[model samples]
Target: MKEIESSNLFPDRLYLIYRVGRLAFSSGIFFLFLSLSSISKLPVAPSSLFILGIYVIVSVALLLFSKKPYTFEFLLDEAVIFTLVASNVLNYNFFSIFLIFPVFFSTIILGSISGTTSLIFGLFLHIIFFLQKHNEGIATGVQTVLNSTALIAMFVAGLKLERKLKSQAFYIKELEKEKERTEFYKRLYEISANMAHEIKNPLASIKGALELIKEGKQNERLLEIIFKETDRLDRIVKDFLHLSRPSSPIKTEIFLPEAFQEILQSLQHFGKNYKLDVEPIKFKTDARGFYSTIENIVRNAFQWADSKVEIHCHKNNHTLEIIVEDDGPGIPEEEREKIFEPFYSKNPNGSGLGLSIVNKFILENKGTVKVEKSKLGGARFVVRLPLSEEV
Candidate 1:
């Protein structure tokens, strides 16, 4: 069941109650007239007025109660029971007809179980009342039963229609989300194309200037800093181009422990200057996405860690779990969530797309990623990958 948001809870409950109360009030008035008319031909005894008084009081109380917050289940059950008893007390042929309306209405709104329960309860009351007043004729009982059966049929049809509508709504929502994603990619491609065109001339000019300066003429430290910054810019541009391009078709399979170990080994070159400890465990995951995701995260940990980083893996029922943590200063609490957003970074020199790419890959593989304070006294990234069913 979809959880009801706090904002909509009270108003929805009140609306349902108000609607049922209105129906009850209208039915109560109609029955009042019928009962009065039926007793007119007979003596106007004190007993008649007393029963009439009880009906009036109950109706008034119900009308007031209907304004309060109540569930459909409570309303349907109470209405069905009250109507059943009232039908016998009024002793009118048309009184049983009122029960049919509530029965049909309950089925349409309360779903199969509650609706059917209300119908059965009302049916039982009708049978008992008819037996007590049998001299009225067999036609009346038959008509009542027929009406109840028709109401049940209508309820089944209404449920089918509701399910169809809900499915359509879900489909539309998915389409809307896809459309938004496409538009974002479109805008990204346009911006990257423009940036590449505009930056080419400046990049060529800087490269030419650096070359013209004799190999030993420039200060070694200054030359190194300039080269590093240029390389960083080049990497950023490459990342932008990659993200703007159409994604490659995914061919995924269950990747074993060895495949993950290979990815970790490849990333180890980047962290050779730092002390890195990698722990492997047997697990299953989508090969393509898992390789790309782990490589990105491990490389990121290497960039931040001072002298040590750790990788651990484990398996939970139907899922492969991995945690990558570093001994570097952890990300601030306020920045952890936003770090996965595209082009967001706390470090001035960071490209900002590393975690974002990891996030995308994890989602595509039907997995999840979360960041928290690690047991290793730094940021820890926990990834959960669903086990591949095909393998």
Candidate 2:
């Protein structure tokens, strides 16, 4: 689980591995009984292969998924593993009581309550099937009693281990959070300086425009300069807010056609200079962030295209792929890396925050965007976002 700590001795990975071992150990017992029944006095129950089949299926399910085990799953494991022990007790094979030790080591790896529950379930099976035989042999009775005592002992021991593991996990998780906070603040500090520089130039342009208007009179050309500079400042501030805020995108099921249509309809005022070749994909992502990404990238395409722009979208593996290309001049290889930097633009009137905003939003959504030479001999912007499996 996401809450499971990385540095703990009882890490989730180890628990998963233990489960696999649990499956293997239980399966091996069944295999032994079935395979050796022909050559030896070894007893094979009719349910041995059935139980093994269940172990395999459940083990496969547990390993394929990334989730914590349920209490009932451990109970099932108890049923399968202790089946042989109960069988052995009924057959007067006291040597097989040694199998009870393996239960302690594995169950102790879990929380005390689960371990206790498992032991109770296992002992219940032992009583129902083999407790009557305990009266027939002193050794059977002694080992059965020891099984109960070991349940209490290991349960107390498991509680302490579980507490120690949990506290360590909590401490490590906190350290990870603190480290992320430190890195975030460091980036914030760097961007604050960039924001100030971007802010200064626009303020100076507005001031100069106001001074000229004050000296003579308000004219269209001078007024336009003020408005343009004001718009630049606004764009910079909005983009800065987008970049500076923490990126914790909440994903939701998104219908791709609906999302794309929202942006396409808004940009219809620009003309039919666009062609969309999109797969009718339905997936999950941060819907708001996805719309922003589509709007910004397509708007940038329109700003650059001379005659036509094309948009293509599809799914690749677990990722959603989006490509926006235009017939405008493509970006030179050297300038491509700087394309997404804040306040960097080739067009004189551009705020230069469009691609930067696009990049920020994509990254926040656990996606990537890149520029490449389009097949149409122009710049192509490619965006990829991971698909949520729930969809």
Candidate 3:
């Protein structure tokens, strides 16, 4: 909903363009005055001095309100250019080249009606000023008509260019909105389908467990089955919640060694051998997100790991690279990319969200998680979190 300056036909751009054009024209006029003085080997003409004074006043007024010039201001600028044209005719020198600049500005900024009015008035004055001196030469008439034709061409071109740019901007904005809507619907559909697929298995297991308990009477093992299935459902819900949570990392200061110490200790519940090698590095990041990222990564390693999981952490310049690898069957190169997709588990009982969450957390922290062949001949997952060159 923010208003764009470009959408307004770049009014500020118009100011810049007009000012630059006037500056260039004025420079040309200055050199012309100097050239005339040198050729005649005389002092500057009084008429040129008079014209220069009028030029200063007009230039100052126009420059002062360049951003929001009134229509009358543009008219005044054109009138001055006409005066220059008359002066050029009386002195028998052609300076009608300056006439197109004002016409171009008016057509672009004040619209075609005002621009057409200025053009007509300029041509009318052209006839009176130059045609009356037709006794001078026929080339003068030809040159004046050519100047008028070029001014008309420049005005028409400016109008079309303005219209084309404005139309393209409008279409680009509409396309962006359409693309956003399309992406929203596509993501909605994906989440719905993944949720249904992940939820169905646990619900089925819980229902089956309950039916068996009801027919055979309550028993310790059956109740445990129901409890376990319910826990699985809870985990599924929690994972989905993690995905839906605000993406911005809740950053705080964290010591890498101590944080990993607590994470590994809590991960003892997995009953898997995990060896940790961490450096005493400190930095600011989302503590909870970092923990989640490490936990999901190690848990995934533990799942496919055979005898033990090896974790190697070290500093690489401004990044902290955490390498988690297992000695079990490594992931194939082809499936590595797809493995991080939601509900893309190779394990029969796995819900397949752990690595996906790991990927999300790493990306949220402005980091990268990559899979490669480990030195230990297993799947090595390397997570690099940017430290921004902190010690």
Candidate 4:
């Protein structure tokens, strides 16, 4: 909408440059005519110089005023055009030919209404000038009519062309936006499909377990299974809800090694064998997002590790890199990328939301994560984050 208004309201840079170039060309032609008139000793009216001087002044004024609001600058240009046409016509009747500039400019810049006004003004001035001269009546009238008609015709043609170009540009912009929207919906559909598939299996299991418990004696084992499945579903729903919510990081200062030490202390209660090799590093960023991301990654590592998990953290220049590896069955090369996708998991008992949640938080915090083969002969997850200058 703004584009449409701008185009109709003002002459673009190309048109401005074109007008300046036209002025230069006209200057050259005027100088050439002056030289010829001097050589031939023709009695050229001194008023011609005054008219040319006035034109140059108006052109310069328009250039200076071009930066003004579109409507104001346009009206100013039209006024200058009128002044030039009136002065030139009155001084030298034949010079009304210069009316072409404003006529065409109005058409391209201000659209049809102004174009029509310019056509009428040009015709009116030229007719009045011809009457004042009162010589070669029919020829002058014929010339005036022809010139006016040609100027109007050019105005009409320019208006049509400008409208067509603007329409095409607007259409192209809309199509590009539609294409992006379509791609977004396509991704959404894929995520929805995965969610349904993941939720269906657990729901069916819970239904069967509940039926067993009701039909037979309420076995504690079956009740336990139901509770476990319910918890799994709850986690799935919680993570899904979290992912759906828009994320905005609340940044704060945090020390990397201190944060890692706290995470390790919390996990020590699980009695899992783990190793930590972290360098002392400090940075300012979203502390909650950082903690949530690292916790998910390390928890997944512990869940899959055979006996031990190795954790490593280091800072290289302005970046902090953390690696977690498990001494268990490593991820297959083909499944590495899929592991980070929502609702994608090889473990039958897994909710498959862990890595996706980690990835989401990291991305929101402007950090990155990737998976590879670890030195421990198992899967390795590496996360890199930009360190703030306050570090």
lDDT of 1 by residue, 1-391 (tens): 2221332343346446646565565456556656776877533344444555564565556565645423353345445444534544443455445555455445444445655666677667666666765777887678667755665665576567446545665666666678778988996886566456445644675576577565655666656756776887787776655444444565555445566567767866665343334334444344555566687787788778877788777667777777888887988899888888666766666666667778877776688999999776778999987766534
lDDT by candidate, in order shown? 0.62, 0.72, 0.75, 0.72
The ten-residue window of minimal lDDT in model 4 covers: 68-77
Off by over 4 Å in 1: 1-230, 241-261, 264-288
What TM-score does prediction 1 earn? Answer: 0.52
Q: How far is candidate 4 from the true structure (C-alpha RMSD, Å)?
A: 8.6
Where does candidate 3 stray beyond 4 Å? 1-136, 217-221, 247-251, 268-275, 332-337, 388-391
**Order of candidate numbers by TM-score, starting with the best:** 3, 2, 4, 1
Question: Candidate 3, residues 49-91: lDDT per residue as tens digits?
Answer: 5676667656755676556756676666667666665555223
Candidate scoring better on TM-score of 2 and 4: 2
**Clash count in backbone of candidate 4:** 1
Superior by TM-score: candidate 3 or candidate 4: 3
User: Each candidate's TM vs. the true structure?
Assistant: 0.52, 0.60, 0.61, 0.54
Give residue 279's lDDT in candidate 2 (0 to 100): 83
Q: 66-181 in candidate 2: lDDT tens per residue?
A: 37656676666666556654544234344234334334544545566666676676567656645567567677677666666665566566667667777887887887888878
Q: Give the clash count for each candidate.
A: 0, 0, 0, 1
Assess the local accuracy of residue 332 in candidate 3 as a C-alpha lDDT between 0 and 100: 95
* Clashing residue pairs for model 2: none
